[model samples]
Target: MLTIIDKYILKKYLTTFGVMLGLFAPIGIVIDVSEKINKMIENKIPVVDILIYYYHFTIYFTNLLFPIFLFLSVIWFTSKLANDTEIIAILSSGISFTRFLRPFIIGASIVSIIILLMGFFIVPKSSEGFNNFRYTYLRGDGKQAMRGESTDVFRQISNDEFIYVNSFDVASKTAYNFTYEKFTKDKLAYKISASRIQWNPKTKRYTLYDYVKRTVGGLDDKIEKLDKKEAKFNFDLEDLTPVVYIAETLSLVKLNRFIEKEKKRGSSNVNVYLVVLYKKYSIPVSAFILTIIAVSVSSMKRRGGMGLSLAIGIAVAFSFVFFDKIFGTLAEKSSFPPLLAVWFPNIIFGILAIILLRNAKE
Candidate 1:
């Protein structure tokens, strides 16, 4: 059950989204090029490479701007419709305000779906290549390895070995209260405990200080407690990536896979990842919510013209984004679930939409 006027509103909003992209995407690229030209000159880089790098970076920014576009697009389009008395015409024609919402929801739903899929599955795959290429060509070498947080006591590198360290000191390359487990054939084969563990990045190995080990070979397990020890093992670091598994670095799917791996290793830094996953879904849903909110807020064209509607739209959108980031960071620090962290902004705005629409209908 669809009406022609509803489709008209949806089309108007989508058209606005496209026009905004066309206007802003190039501006983003130009601004980026202007800022980065000096860096390119300092590095003695070529024009082509610089262009490619900026283009890759543009993808990141474009993704960031998408939600903003969604808000403004809906606001601008709906405000125009109201100003022209088209909405009044529809209402007088026996169409309820709620009925007018159907097409806008459908349009926003489509766009939001595309954004979620791209964020989670598509963009991250491309980002891997773009980022690696940048690191190899644009960035400096001698990149420092990652550091671990004190909150997480256990570390996992792969399937076979799991380690527990009391405290890890980044500068000293040492860990206190170190315990190691090596599994083979789905059974624990060796267990080592150390008072201190030191890492040698050159060799990619760890040397355990004041070590004791137990080897489970036969029915009788032989335990050897060493006063001090050295061993070549891969349990040298903790966390998925200090710089590697960063939000900016991951799109969506890669982020999920990374969180899963870290959880398996008994790591506790997944709050950020979980929030990001929720955000990937929530942001797209915002397209639908914002569409309804815009229609409610702007479709009447009061003393405030399109300029006022646009300003309100921008302010509301900015507030949502700011609160979303702050809450997500807080969730990362606290025990807030990632899904809640990600969707909190959308939930607040959706409620706002319901209230606004109820008022508008009156």
Candidate 2:
């Protein structure tokens, strides 16, 4: 049994959300196009391709900024309602403030479901195109495809296996100063060192330059040397070194498997992937929390009307973004846990929402 007030408020909430997207998305596309237009022209990129890129850009930017839009939209319409005395009339009609919040929660739930679906299924595919266009035409080709924290990578591939590479060249499919070592039961079993290693896509094998292999026995070590050799190792090219956007291009299932595999490999950059994983889950939950905060704050009719409410909304929105970035950076650079970093913003604001909601209720 949907009351008139519930229907009215729900319509307003969802309408404002859609209108916010309509208002900001084109502005974003325009600014993005302006910035990239010169590069597109210089690179002789086709108009159709550029337009397609903006289509993906629209999706990417809209998803990236959806929470901000949602927060602002809730504040806008609710403040308008407060100004018009609609909330006062409704409350005077014997409706509890908690009951009044039902439609907003319902609206938030709807938006959260949409966003969760987009983040998991659509964003990954669109991000691939958006990033490919940036790297290929916006940035120059021949640069290292992957941008790990360090060019010189060292990792434990297993309990007794370790690998090292000084640098990798994505253009040439080659690694410099490559080494792999294997140990068994606390004894060195074998070690392989090479001046360079190149991947052959067709043959699916590695060509090692100036390769040296040392096989250790109980009391003695046997060494073998070769100028060049084709070898098959336990890892693939993506396993040894993946591009920065690799995680962004994977679906939820693949991303989890990737993180687990990286954890097993003792990769130093696993935190980065974990951050992405946590954010997908966090964003949806934040939607509901932010809706509560927005509705509670804006439902009051302040002396300055919609202007004051919007000012407060903007401040809170920026604070959310700031907290998100600060903690995300801390997680990546320091020992801060990725899960904590992703959820900390939601936790802090959720507490704030509770306090505000209590005050609003009283």
Best of the candidates, lDDT: 2
Compared with the true structure, what per-residue lDDT tens digits does model 2 show for residues 1-362?
Answer: 77888999999999999999999999998888788777677777778778878887888898888779999999999999999999999999999999999999999999999999998999987876676567555664323323212356677778888888876654366777899999899878999999889999999999999999999977888999999999998876655554466677678998898889888777788888888888889999989999999999999899998999999999998899889989987997888999999999999999999999999999
Clashing residue pairs, backbone N/CA/C < 3 A, model 1: 120-253
| Cα lDDT listed for each candidate | 0.72, 0.85
What lDDT is reached at residue 97 by model 1?
A: 86
Each candidate's TM vs. the true structure?
A: 0.71, 0.79
Candidate 1, residue 173: lDDT: 65
In candidate 1, what are the lDDT values of residues 117-154, reduced to their tens digit?
A: 87877655545445543444444422311223432366
Q: Residue 135 of candidate 2: its Cα lDDT?
A: 53
**Most TM-score-accurate candidate:** 2
